[model samples]
Target chain A: MFKLIESDAPQRRRICEIFVDGEPCQAMIGEPLAAALLKANCVPMRYTPVSGAPRAPLCMMGVCFECLVEVDGTPNVQACATPVREGMHVRLIHGARSIGQLGGAAQ
Target chain B: MSTFDVVVIGAGPSGITAALTAANRGLRTALIDEQLSPGGQIYRNVDAVDNGMQTILGPEYLHGRTLTTRLQHSTVTRIQGASVWQISDDLEIAYLQAGVSKTLSARHLILATGAMERPSPMPGWTLPGVMNAGAAQIMMKTAAAVPSGDVVLVGDGPLLLLVGKQLLDAGASIKGLIQTSPIAQAGKAMRHLPKALLAPGYLIKGLRLLTHLRAGRVPFFRTDEAVNILGSDRVRGVSFIHKGQRIELTVDTVLLHHGVIPNVQITRMLRLEHRWDVDQQTWKPCCDGHGRSSNPSITICGDGAGIAGALAAEASGAIAGLDACFALGNLSEGERQKLVRRPARAHRRQLRIRPFLDTLYRAPEWLSAPLDETVVCRCEEVTAGQIREMARLGCKGPNQTKFFSRSGMGPCQGRMCGLTVSSILAAENGVSIEETGYYRIRPPLKPIPLLALSQARVARSAGTERNSQPNEDPTHE
Candidate 1:
């Protein structure tokens, strides 16, 4: 698991609970979703569609879509680019996301 | 739909400077970026970063706050969290804002999109625990987070050394650093030392970072070998050769870096003339002294124009901004000439160390040109061997390789693997990278949702739309 060192210690950040794969994880408000997931030791954000190989945030920037995750039933969202919020729901992408799982539930 | 006299695509040092210069000069300017904050990646979360993080991230990063603070006081409109999906030649920009599509028109566009780490797709790079050194830098800059346990950084370039020092400062246990800068290349860099010494501060900083890494008890091995990250699904360790002897280290995470290159998605999509930069080993838009591309309406400054660090980008940004103002009739010929002198001089002065750096950490063919079983395109899962086979089949260029192997047709749109494929194909075809060429970039450049794209089409009102403005008519071309 990656270590988070008292992040943003000087600034009093609003901490909230977010659900990932139906499990509760503590997240800082407005922090990147990928960072929060990494801090929570939840790597392997997605599996490659071609080889089903597990992949995590490679660049932590938007360029490498290796950090693609499903948030609130929306598929292929970049966790590195998106911000965490209270009661946010995230799911790791297992290879190609079907339209059913995605459902485009959150616009 | 909103309109801007000048639309700056990136909010980094260069973009900010360009926006401020144009806005302060009475042109309507809007600076857009994907980050949640004002500063781009170099200064990610400048305002939110605590004092502790600031000390750990170092002074160069802290310097971003000054630019952002000045940006806050300026009249420039700062738009954050917007992923620009498309940029037309006519300066019609379409982007996704909070999951919805928004289109804006601009008289002039300045893209300070900045530089991205060169894609080093060695064996096991697609694994979960292996990432770029810049990613580690990003994690630290944004959240003060670091990989725990044994961490090994493998590659060459000033960024690798800088990240090693930063990770050590953040209290991360760096198990080792495997530098792949060839000894022969190091000898070549010696020739450029005199010219590089003109910018002594850069060399001094390099020395300081190396010293810090040494003081941290981190082992360093400069191997003229392509380092391999050995793992089934996650990084277990790294194995490489040193002096005809194989050396291996146990590690939890592997970070790779080999300098950075201009991010040319916008320029490529616009089809502005690009030349393969042999020194930096990447494609850069052919721009004038003021960063103006073949398309006079667009200007690319900063690393997006080329990898001329932050200070150089700031100067180039000023030049680009001043040029834009002059083009838009804000400054007379005499006024523009006088205003351009300082930034122009500063730009040249700041880039004095580039040749030394480019040669010292040139992109190693052995590292980037992967072989059988090594993945080239992450999205499509195309292997390097497959791409080589495509080249053997007489594929015309990178565009044909797309149909042959589906390498560049992934969701990432070839951002992660384009350069690697280019190198592999070039080597296989016995041609220079310049001759092999790069992937043909198109919109949506950043992978916007299909739903958003459809919605945007439905709500379209620009050049191609039904109620199009006469000035924005499709036949204007």
Candidate 2:
């Protein structure tokens, strides 16, 4: 079921604006959101509780949720696991600190 | 790299079987295994606390009992706890063990790394208490620890049902069993239900477990899906969306599982040709009746080929062992024929149950997982949305995805996400999952430390190099 279609590079370059941390990030049309953010080096996908360790991608295929980042104001979207949208907004979950910070309620 | 006539990676059923067969036939064998003991993940031995007996059954006890004892008697040189990283064309293996690097080489190689749980992701799946069912079983088998408090076992594979029984047996409270598929698929595959009734005792064990759960008035939700796992740190509860309605259940432990995908890291590393099996959600090494791979010098067997359960793995191992003997010129034509025929029948019998499993636990379309703003590659933190966009932009294949998005390029390599990513790629391109094969596996088979490996090779070749090296030979001049 695989078809190799030639896409017009100029036309494929449709521009879209997505917000990351209230900052507008320009992205190409038909590109995943994670790629744009990664290209921009906007990491620390999610924050841990105890040590407040920043965890990014662990298992790229969605098996592990280490790359989860908040999208559109919702917390815990697997950034590496999910695709990029034209105008998606992503936010980092900040309450937790480290593996040690796990016990306390979301501060 | 220290080369041998044959290298068998993994101490599991297939690797041990291949090593024993090859070595007994006088092919110099190097058996590289990951665990301290030979048994693979499924038959991992339990570490005892004191004098308390660890009761074992099913594949754990049966395969462990026989394979472990056989490995002890084999001529194979076993290297334990070796984590292979890559395999070269010369059959050289780079691996890490006990914080040391090492390398080994072989002319002919066999891989039997086996399988692991296929992690099916859902919303809130990242919650701390959400664990794969196999991981739960492994803990019980190896560490004798159960998920504390009320536990809910979800999914419909026979393993889930059996594990539920094991958990109950281990004195853990089972809140409910969530079966995602109907039981008729199981019943249909077992056409000779009355005769081989005892052979498929695992089904009965499942039924018994179901009956006990029912009789005990334990709640069970069938044809359901775990929509989300709720809790900030530890698992507080799980929301089951049944028939489009969300019902939150109070449970601290959420055991989630779908099925297993073949662990083909070592096999793929050898550059063995493979085929995608849509039913099992994994790639299997291409093998003929004799378990010989595309590389004539290499062979594969057991779950690495497919998930036919332990008995089938053993039967396949025996056949593979016999074939290895043939390759080594140790088997007479008659002996090989006799040994091979019996196991072929056993394999046929095992195949009967697979159709049922395939129909019953068909990876729910809902679980196909849509391209969202979620991360698809946890190692690189790549998102599915990114992968799809790349695919549209010409990152058409899993390999291309790896190159462009670093999707399958990570520490666990692609072990944890390869199957899911392949499925996603296939879906994106409107192709069957079969069309999108698994990510290529290269080996040491396990990770290894460089200094130790070099030291070992150096120690082994100390005397021989002086005699064989042309530069060191005074007579050559």
Candidate 3:
């Protein structure tokens, strides 16, 4: 797993726990959720809807949406753009996201 | 709605410099950016990057610290972490921040939106482990993390070499450095060496990077092309042709980069006239020597105007800022000219080595026109084959292809695939990429939730009576 280089600069680490695919993972408080996941060796953040192929964050700058994952029940959240918070819930997106109630007929 | 004399659309070096200049000229200025900090991508998190990483990023990045500090002290109002969605003809900007949609008006707009790594779409590029070299650098800059395991650097350009050297310096195992520039180009590239040496610092720095790589004994391959990425679910290996012989390297991570192209979404949305730069092989807004666009009210500076690197970007920003001041009657014509003299000369000098660099790292035509099976748009899963088929079936342009196959209609709004699609259409239709055109950018440039839009409208409506005349001329007073 990739870890940050130990720096002589004073460490301002903010420890927090986040749930990834139902597993509890430790993360920095304000670090990008995607970076934290990669540090934990979480490859294949999601599966492409078209081919059911695994994909991970390519551009951590949020230009590429390869790191899209469901965060706290919100679908299509860019993990690279979103920051990690305490008790944040992140779910690995599987193949072909469903549109949910937004696509359903009005009741 | 809040109004200002100038609204700089990005907080990078150019945008910050513009804002600082405008504010120093006593114009009400507003600077908006999507990142939480100022410094854009090149010097991202300049203030927060640890000293250890500082040594890795080099002095160019340290320059951002001074710009950021000046911006913080200036009178310009900074709205960080805001995504600008729409820009109107009358210089009105609609943006979303913290789930609140807001609109601001400016008499003049300076777009310093900067650049994105040119899309290198190849076989297996869509795999998980394949990423842009710039992306990897961003991770290192922002997160202080480097990719573990065997990482292979691919493609051409200064960034490829710089990142390879950085990763090796950081004690990461690199499998190889695959250069896509044909070996013969080196002889041609040297023809401009005398002119390039005029900017001795850049040439020396580049030479130093190359020397370091050689000293590290990093296996370098002058491959004719990066033909394919060999992987099933993730990047397992990469295949390229070196001297008419196929070679393969097994690796866990593959970082690719060709060069950078202007992020022209905002400028295109504003419908400003853009000219295709043949040497750079990208479409950039038509701006004058001082960064004034075809539309007098709008100006484009920095890499968004053209790829002239950071120093040129800052110089352009200063010129645009002074020009905007003169336009707003804040500075007299004589004073503006006198102020811009230094920056103008510096900007010209910074552009001295561009011809040499452009020739040395010209992206091969095949990289732009990827193999038919390679996926062009990752958002919509549109492939080169599908785009070509659409072109053959009388698809006039990218917009038509969008309807037929949904190529640029994804969350990225064609940022990732626009250039590739245009190149394919141009090649198939026997026209220049300029004639092929780009995706028609519309409102809501960044994704905003439905709830936010409604709430913003309601809040604005409530304040309409108090600040009703958002379009009122600020100079009239």
> Candidate 2: global Cα-lDDT?
0.63
Model 1, runs deviating above 4 Å: A7-11, A98-107, B457-477
Native contacts present in each candidate (fraction) = 0.69, 0.02, 0.63
lDDT of 3 by residue, B141-191 (tens): 877888887888888888888998888888778888888866666788899
DockQ of candidate model 2: 0.02
Candidate 2: tens digits of C-alpha lDDT, residues B1-477: 566777777777667766776777677788887666667766665222111214423444544657777778877788986666656554556666655767777766677777767766665555545566765665554433455568887776877876777676666777877766544556655654544444555556657867866776667786544356677655678777665677788886677777777777667665667887766656788899888899877777888888887777777776776776776567887989977898778776766666656666656665656436555565565666777787688655788888887777754567666766877778888877666666765433333334455554332221112355446532120
- The most accurate candidate by TM-score is 1
Tens digits of per-residue lDDT, candidate 1, B336-419, equal 989999999999998899999999888776766676788888889998888888888998578889987888898889888888
**Error of model 3, residue B289, in angstroms:** 1.1
Per-residue accuracy of model 2 over A2-41 as CA lDDT, tens digit each: 0111223334345578888888877644333444554454
The 10 consecutive residues of candidate 3 chain B with the worst lDDT sum are B457-466
Interface RMSD of 1: 1.9
